[model samples]
Target: MITYDPHKWLDHFFDIRGSLVKEISGRVLICVFWSAGVVYFDKNYHDVNISSLLHTLVGLALSMLLVFRTNASYDRYWEGRKLWGGIVNETRNLVRQATVHLSGERDLVVHLAQLNVDFAAACMYHLRGAKIAGMLESQHPPLTIATQMTFALQEARRRGAITDIILASMDQNVQLLIDYLGGCERIRKTPLPFAYVVHLRRALVVYCFSLPFALVDTYGWATVLDTLVISYVFFGIEEIGVEIEGPFGLDENDLPLEDICTTIRHNLFALVELEHSEPDKMPEGL
Candidate 1:
């Protein structure tokens, strides 16, 4: 994942609002062309009417609403990103602490490392809308979700070959995992208010539909081009906001959680191995 400092440049490039000017400019050109057509058909239509006023007002309102939507969506998107950043830090901290405190202790170190991997995978699955298999039990169970989950994790700690200090670190790691999970749940459960979404969508549709009528009298044939460009710009931004709000999944643009998890695994393993083994060159695969 992106481990670099969260820069506004990233926001400027990725943020939806940044393209509004371009969208508006292109549509204005089309509107002008269409207005010329209408003038050619009937010069009297060149005079602005109430419909023209309404069109201007609607365009202005749509622009403002698009800005507001982008702001709100980015807020949610950034918050989710920040939360994941915390998870990465905490995960690394847990492993580092375990390695330091449990020096010369291999058994517990292995167990803790495995737990770290499992936790990251589980969280990924949960966020991607997958049912956390092995998390629930009501079907029929000698060991229910409650008994199995708590017991398995605790038993891993109790029986693992780590030193006392390492065990303590593992406990802290578990708590951190719980907190991260709760944060993820909060993002998942709480969405943009339904009323707000409904209002914004209705406004967008009305704006797009009314645009043609308002511009047609003045721009004629150019109205079609103007309408398509303006409509796409507004819709494009709304689509991005919708995508970012979830911030999880295998979408090409979604946060790269899998890559982050793999990097953590590689780093932790490399650190542990370096501490014990001498560096050696390896031959190409057999």
Candidate 2:
């Protein structure tokens, strides 16, 4: 995941530079060839009739639309990135509060803190469409409800004091966990609208196909190179937009949620002054 900061664009672009260049180059070549062929055919058969004025207008519109498309897609990508940034901060905040509030209640405190870490990892895997087996190792649905209630009962018994104030504090912290889970679900379930994706895709394809028609009349065989060059830029932007729309996935350019989850785990563990231990080996069929 690109860190959520303004100064690191170079690092982010460098990370995905090769893939970007490759996609753009392919599109440029395609446009160039199509443009050149159309020009050649027009000259040979006297069939081309596109006016210079009309060509210029079409080119202008195409350029504007491409720019707009690039901006819109980037906006969506950045929004998703920002949402993940919120998740990271919220996770840290939750741990900090839990540690401070639950002090002196060693077992209850440690377990709750650990669960926060686990939940963070679970959310990350779920968002990326990765298998959930690892995150769900200790508990399963239906059973988890009962198990969670039982765990709460234990924590209630283990509270620092039996006063109402302590109970209220515990309740508040527990509710924070619920809120975090809800936030993750919101991001994972809600995607950019289908119509927007469809429209963008259609626009890109139309521009690609029309490039040959637009350039063929003037450049003839030379239009091939021109089309290819322009197509490279346009296609590269379109492809990047597609990759970024759902930024949670495992793609190279997608947010690195796993790394973020790892950070949460380390932070929570450190706060409790717990000696770090390697996670237990997962079971054979787990």
How many residue pairs collide in each prediction?
A: 4, 9
Model 1 Cα lDDT, one tens digit per residue, 160-272:
54545655555665566667666866887788889988898888766765566577666666666776677767777876677667767665456788887787688667656
How far off is residue 237 in model 1, in Å? 1.2
lDDT of 2: 0.61
Tens digits of lDDT, candidate 2, 1-286: 4444567776555554436676666656665666666777788877764555665665687667657666766676676666656656655665565556555566655776666666666656665656566435543332243245336535655664335564555555445545554554565576556786687667667666676666665666766677676677667767776667666777767777778778877877776763222346433553
For model 2, state the Cα shift of residue 139 in Å. 11
RMSD of candidate 2 to the true fold? 7.7
Task: List residue ranges in candidate 2 displaced over 4 A.
Answer: 2-18, 23-28, 58-68, 134-184, 274-286
| Alpha-carbon local distance difference test for all models | 0.63, 0.61
After aligning candidate 1 to the native by TM-score, how far in Å is the CA of 31 from where it should be? 14
**Residue pair clashes in candidate 1:** 34-219, 34-222, 35-218, 35-219
Error of 2 at 151 (Å): 4.7
